[model samples]
Target: MSNPDITTPVRRPRRLRTSQVMRDFVAETHLDPAQFVLPAFIAEGIDAPREISAMPGVYQHTETSLLKAAEEAVAAGVGSIDLFGVPTPEHKDASGSQAWAADGILNKGVAALRREFGDDLIVMADTCLDEFTDHGHCGVLTTDNWGHTVVDNDATLPLYATMAVSQARAGAHVVSPSGMMDGQIRVIRDALDAEGFEDVAILAYSAKYAGAFYGPFREAVGSTLQGDRKTYQQDPRNARESIMEVQLDIEEGADMVMVKPAMPYLDVLRQVADMSTVPVAAYQVSGEYAMITAAAQNGWISREPAILDSLTGIRRAGADIILTYWATEAAQLLA
Candidate 1:
């Protein structure tokens, strides 16, 4: 009647998108450096940062460079750093004894980081044998009745326990057992408690899968694996099994749980997040990094936007923490 309220009410949702400030204000998920944990590879002999061919912009840092990288991460506001070691071929052995050695490369890295950063940044050591083993299996390998070289679950547990204790003693704030071996969490937890390291936490790689996504990672670690990790790691086709893995790890004393290859397995991440009481982490593995970097390098996409979008998607999928190569860059961008 009053000209039918001629000016139709603005049903537009464009108000929130009108400006950068408005968009930032209404953004559903925001990424911060505190939510990132950078995974770094420290090789035994390199004097400088060596780039992995498959993974552009990522480097295998020497101890000195490793410290510098840690400093960079801290300065950029990253909350934590996870360290992995690449022992020279001469140091690798059948037992992967170096993984538990008191002065192992990884342990040394942990000690160095602790001394340098102290409580300012969280230092997590990768408690696995794959990078240190000559065979490149995640655990100790034994022969089955059929003469197949199978990962010996029972035999591997003690090694993991010892590795956890060594890492803890070296001042790792957290020990992440990425090996999919059975009873590893329980063994590591008991070992840590026995050694009077009751405060050291275990971050279990609970739902790791036997995916081709780890190809670049194997290269990064200098792995000499002859075959796939299908026997130990979970099948990519099974989501329900991931829940069981998460439940088992939680029951066995995991302080936190993670699902690897974050982007492709986000459904598994969501399920684990919904089911777990502890914090859930998502690892954006090497292949995932390679894919985006390659695409961006080829001018197929904008790198910065793609990186942020990928990380935001992981956050939206319920990752309380994200392990990514882009941590330092993302942190600077967020800052």
Candidate 2:
């Protein structure tokens, strides 16, 4: 039935996509449980785990519940858990002193996890003062020369150094400085070394942006933030600025760097990955989780597939590690 003058087309790409097994065999991007990191919140005095209303299925856990969550994540093959401590209002002060106390909730959580997991899981502490500060700013506030109250970056460095040492003493394998303060990495790194925690690593939030995606995170941590953090955190519109930040962190002894609010900034993530010599991490922030959950609950999308796809996309965009609220479920799904 074919004309002699017309040769049949030979390149049919659909032949490779004929079946699921075939697709799997040729898949370029993949996800693994070992690449997932769970971000957990442990409140000081709560007797039971309280589910965050804005972020359904995520909780502000008690110490008991936090251990249980870690056990589940470990069993599912999740690689790491980053702990955020929520202090009682009475414990909060201008300097966020509780942040560096040995008995502090965060340090306690770190010690407990170290005793239980004992290197089975990587324990990371959020080495910032936001959750422990009355003002809910990431650092100490001061009146600048212009009479504007702003986060004092220079003054915050020493506090971060002390906090990192405290977390290291409590057996945290890594201390993540999420305050986005300049010179923090060098200070924390030097302090950890001086305190005999040279083995401990620093995960710098190098490219954290000032975005509205952190709303649910504020509720989860019981944040008392007065205004905004735009003065320190990078503007969402700028892409090249992230490179400068990442480079500075690396130069300051950052073991790894993170790009937060993963999906909206995949372009930045990709660019960072291409140039950086160290491993790259991305955070699937609370708002990203909330929106997907809400839409799926309304039957707008298939929840499981959407979660997997979103995670896969991040991996394809060049993230070596992904900090996500869905870590346990996603790990189980992959398993």
Give all TM-scores, in the order shown. Answer: 0.97, 0.98
Give the Å error, residue 91, model 1.
0.5
Taking the tens digit of each residue's C-alpha lDDT, what string does model 2 give over 15-113?
Answer: 889999999999999998898999999998889999999999999988889999999999999999999999999999998999999999999999999
Clashes in model 1: which pairs? none
So what's the TM-score on candidate 1? 0.97
lDDT of 1 by residue, 87-124 (tens): 99999998899998877788888999999999999999
Name the runs in model 2 displaced over 4 angstroms.
1-8
Candidate 2 minimal-lDDT segment of 10 residues: 2-11
| lDDT, candidates in the order shown | 0.93, 0.95
Instruction: Report model 2's TM-score to 2 decimal places.
Output: 0.98
Evaluate candidate 2 by giving its C-alpha RMSD to the native, one decimal: 1.4
Error of 1 at 155 (Å): 0.3
